[model samples]
Target: MSRRLRLLVTTVGLAALAWLLLASIERAIALAERFEGLPQGVRWLVGGVLLLLVSLGAAVTVWWLRPRRPRAPVTAPDRTSLEARIAQLRHDDAGVEELRSELTELDRRRASARTYLAVFGEISTGKSSLIAAMVPGAAPASDARGGTTREVTHYETSAWGDGWTIADVPGSAEAGGEARERLARAEALRAHAVVYVCAGDLTRSQAEELRWLGDFGKPLVLAVNKADQWTDIERDQILQHVREQADGIPDAVLAISAGGEERFTRRLADGSTEDVTRRRPAQWQPLRDALRRLLAAGPSALEAQRENAVLASLHERTGERERAYRADEAERIVSRYARRAIVGAMAAVAPGSDLVIQGALAASMVRALASLHDVRVTDVEVDNLLRQVRMTLRTGTSVVLAVAGNALKAFPGLGTLGGGVLHAFAYALIFDSFGRALAATLAERQALDQADAGERMRELLNEVDASRLRRLADLTGEALRLRHEPSD
Candidate 1:
């Protein structure tokens, strides 16, 4: 019912109810007055009966006028259905399995409570020295030769009661370095932040390597080691060069001398040992402070990285699966339309009837292919595609049989049947070729704009083999004969 009509009906019914209620009260008062001359007990019983009837009437009216709640709408199981589809795709696709493994490992890393900071640099870049300076007693042997650290070394410590790990990975410039580089990159991928150490100004190759590291989307700190060897002016120049090479991605660039000069203990003439201090390099306090600031940003930074990585993976995998499903559906649609076109061609009674039936069939197939990709084309677009296919077929070798079929129509009796059969076969071949070409375009996610439609359609039609057309025509002929044959 309309809102105005319902309101009018409700108002009228309420007014009538109010009038009835008033009349009942008036009647009860009149009856009580009449009973005024009766016994007191009789008057009391009459009053009680009238009160019960009024209460029952009010209850009925309120129950009938109460508001009703609307029912909830049913929703599809999107998440469950998607999960099932993903599982099936994974079972059948190797790429999906690889992506799934990567996502699973990423999830595990995100769940870890401890933070990792990886130290990355080329060989002899003071990586070990910088780590030793920050860690005090946990110093590993520092060698000038390359490949000093062949495996990842973890140094665990507590700062402000929170546990943190520093990973010293192998240098990327070592002999047989491809494996080491892969391992170093994998370690860096799992780190919350990276501290890149360098001895002096960066070379062109080293600068490119730093840029590659920045692509991982983690916080970075650039630490220039062995600053004691460079003069103040040279140090400033080196720092500026390093900053330019870091591309504004590093949170901080710090200059520190991780390798202090050698100190010796000498025996004095009185047989006591004396300590001698030589040229002592500065401590790595600046690098430590920079790292502490990055850590202070807390777990939200790592969580954001995880969210981005997972979202990217989900989008890529979902698109791949959706395209695969659409491709399969497009093939099914083409096969269905091809069969229908064949049947329609076989039923043509006259030479010219084949054109009308085949034209309609081909247009339907084009629209069906577009629907598979969720694309909408105008009537003009469909007509253009059909015209292109028809023109191609008329100019190609397929034209000879079609022309001969039309020529046969001049004869009577058996010649009409033969001409109709020839026309139907030729039309079926054209429709089948057009459908396959359209399906290929949709599968490749190509747009059906006029600019490339003719060229793309011709290229696809040329790829259709003559043998396949002949085989399809013969099969259609046999199927039509079987369907029309009389049964015993």
Candidate 2:
């Protein structure tokens, strides 16, 4: 702005402030005069109330601005307790044999008493070349298109010290590489220390991986690979940025070249061009120095943290297995109850009382599913949940019967069974929808959510996929045949 305009704006701001100040002073004077006119007791009461209000406002301000404490990091249980938990899962038939195998491998590696280091990074980050440079005469496959390393390969190297073993694992961040990333992570946790290789500053995923390693207390070094591509100043800046990004996670952050092959065309004196391949000399002295310092503590000193990391990973795996087991068991229970509902509907002589008859079965199925998911539910809660389901089914009864009629027509064999089969199939859909809705709500909220389950039931009642209808029809047929069989 021009000098005159700037002056005008500044003057206006000052004038506004002065006007506000004068208005506040006048208001305070008027309040004082009114207070003097009041009785002494009322004046004291007013003053006390104003003091209390001001004190409360100050207290609230302080509370709003208070510094919050960070949440404590999660720690894995000791090996003995972790193994006990895994054994309990096995006894429960949770299919945790793979977790058991992980424990077995953990013990085997510990028994070897070797210092293990894993080279970890995303695809095409020179992880393989770095390994080849560290281990003489050891060449690992590398492709410019990425994902060349598919499995974990260990090389015994005495470069750092005796019994030092380096592991080369698959790279992370590949398309369809989630399985390989899991393998790479498990191997990293199995090691005494890890070197996270990156070509530049950390990406979001890379930073997260480093944080995960830190959470497991894994000893780490951040290596900025392919450093030969940048000049000295640029390399130094990148190293500083990497160090800041990794911060407390890695023991050291250094720039190094992994000595990869570069292909180019050479012209001879005869003027004919010849293809030539040359390997870049690896410049990883700083990396070597960092590894030496990290390993100076020896494998024995690092064993506790490594074991903790492995057990923590195993604990997570076991929990996943347990959830899967519960889900499968819940499905079986729902199918059983749904079959029972179909049989009950088929046998009922009175068509109008079918819903009243299925109410008890629905309640039973809810209890069964809740128990399977380890969700505690009271008798009152179960009754209330079933009441809600009954109301939902009442509203969607026509929709459910329509779906059942469509199912009967869809299957030629089922259509000849008569009208009773339509009622039976409707019951099957009802029980199936109710059971599934309750099971899902219990699994997610860990409590009986009447409103959510009722909404889900309404949705499931109208949803008649071909596969579901076929299964229900087959079940009705089987149940009817069994009922007609003579009592031996």
Candidate 3:
């Protein structure tokens, strides 16, 4: 709004508020005068009752409007149930041995009785310096440039307690450091406690990483490193802002200077300038105190949550592997069905008789794909799906035929293969479209989502892409060649 409009609204609002205040005062005075004539005991009792009612009402209102803490996004699945899922996935695809290894490591870590602490944050956020300060016995190299820590390094430190190891993980948000970020995150998950080091207020990515770590329900501390860079007042302000951004995610938010070498130019007696570097003393006592308090319960007491985090990570990794395996299997299944459709079309009695003849073949392909994805389907649903495919093919037969003709022209040699090659190619397109659509829908919805499948089928039917046409042409030629083979 314009300044004039804002001023007018403000003036009217203030005037209305003043009038309301005066009216309230006038009502209170009138009520007091009436109470003056009443018995003193009765008036006192009435006033007490009114005050109690008002207090109760205010308390209820405040309770209703209270702010609620946000729940974490990560959920730890039951260990037994998660193991069952990984076992079943391993049974289906033998490539998930790494997931099995993760479980094995989980058991090994639990048996070792070690408390792991991972320091995580963005690049050049003093994570290495913080680790160096936390563990006086070990020295982790720190640089002004970001991404100095390329690998996860564990330091055995007796400062906190025996069997307490701290991990110096690679900084996140570095240029082309996604793999290292993943490494950092995985290491963080393996730890019983995490110290998220930051030089200032939490960046958006830092906040998100903090939330992810917090969701695991681990002991997490948001440590603002390099506190010496700001004044005391400024440091407090930044800490408060970081706390607000972090909210209930971190157990505690503390500011500590992870002292590192400071570089400056020095002038000798001859007034010649020389570069000088000196190590600054670390002031990370607050962080040490916080971690001590967080880990006071010992490693064994925190093993359950640590296992849950590892299992949750494994579940996610195994799920990714399962999806990848299904995708590859779905491709093979679709190709096999498409080739069979081409052969069936070539063996048909009439030019377009394969449409009616291949109904059972199409239904079989759908069932196979659905079974691969663990989606059970009734025969009625299968038939209905095939019926929808038939209706879509009926409407787009001309487009399919046109695409086949174009493919024949594109590959002149295929045109001389046989008289029914066009029909064979069209059937290849139809079944290819149907199988791909069903596979995608099954993978996405894990159900017989007929509408979504039909829509995808329609789109694929009209997709006369060069690669697809070439593949179908090749399949049609192969089918014709196999049809003329001698019966041994």
Candidate 4:
């Protein structure tokens, strides 16, 4: 009921209650006067009973008229429900599917008992010889010249009954080697631990490659092969240099000879001793021991590394998809608000009315943008943003357009239409730029502050192209014109 009607009813009811109370008091007085000649004790008992009944009635009325508490609001849905709703809106099915595939692969890898230890290095780094030595009777061909191995070669064996695979990657120094390098890195990413073999001091590129492999957070062992080829001092210098260059990589660095030739004494048939030179078997026992210790660190460590790699890949893929989605959504928002601004401009009847209508339209656009991006903004913040925009326009190209539009309004005939079109185009451009800037800021999950938002708006306006604005205005005009045509 209306407030006035409720007050009227309350007043009438109160007056009736007062009248009844007065009548009851009058009757009680009359009764007391009639009982004045009776015994004093009997009259007192009757008065007490009447007083108790009146008090009980007054208490009941007060209880009935008291206010009630309001009902609680409905509860919100759970997080999973909210996430499902967001997914539906975002429509990121492809990214989600790719993530599912990666996770499934990770689970499969975890179920396997084999531990892969990939050997990564430049060409002619003895990676092949090292693998051959690590696995007896599994010698792979090698050459003195670099780029001998053109593909990834895997040697499978068992160490102390635990299955292991040693992968030898082709030298990454060939012409058009970027593709091969990428493939090698991909192989390294899948390895539980890495063994990087180099015959000499690490080059700048080699150091960078080592660092890149270590970025996957796997255990790495740097083996300086051909240790017997250099003097003791030179070997120490190489080790120290590699350690300095590689920084945190190489859980342990060992000196070993995988292909160094050695001289041995031979007895001739003519009772004379002769010296014979031959390629010695690879002596990589220290390197093997280091690798064994790394693998023995337990399955938990390996699983953790695998999980990190998979999660990192998933994060990157999902991040790319989210960025693309946000960009597309932002463009749609700008186009939508630009069209709305154009409509408001076309309806302008006076020069001053253009400013008021455009300002209100921009405010509405800002509100819609905040809602779409899930940004929390207050009316005061929105008003501040609009004020900044107006201040900026007053001293820029928009001012020139505003003056031209007003001058066009002074003429007759086609002048009015020209003026409205100019006004509409100018407002449309301004709202479009503002919407894009707001979208970008919200995409970064930032609060809408006046100073930063104003700066972004000004930057976007400065970067605006005349041709693009003209095209947008033309498209909007064409759309509006088409809508006004009579149906067939």
lDDT of each: 0.66, 0.83, 0.82, 0.70
What is the full ranking by lDDT, best candidate first? 2, 3, 4, 1
RMSD of candidate 4 to the truth, in angstroms, is: 29.4
Output the TM-score of candidate 3.
0.82
Candidate 2: residue pairs that collide: none
lDDT of 3 by residue, 419-483 (tens): 57878888888888888888899999999999999999889988879988888888777877788
Estimate the lDDT of model 1.
0.66
Model 2 lDDT on a 0 to 1 scale: 0.83
Q: lDDT tens digits, residues 74-130, model 1?
A: 222343444455675636666566445555655665675667778998888878777
Q: TM-scores of the models, in the given order? A: 0.47, 0.78, 0.82, 0.62
Judge candidate 3 against the unseen true structure and give its global Cα lDDT, from 0 to 1.
Answer: 0.82
Which residue pairs does candidate 1 place in steric collision? Answer: none
- Count of backbone collisions within predicted model 2: 0
How far does residue 183 in candidate 3 sit from its true spot (Å)? 1.2
Model 2, runs deviating above 4 Å:
1-73, 78-85, 88-95, 138-150, 349-356
TM-score of 4: 0.62
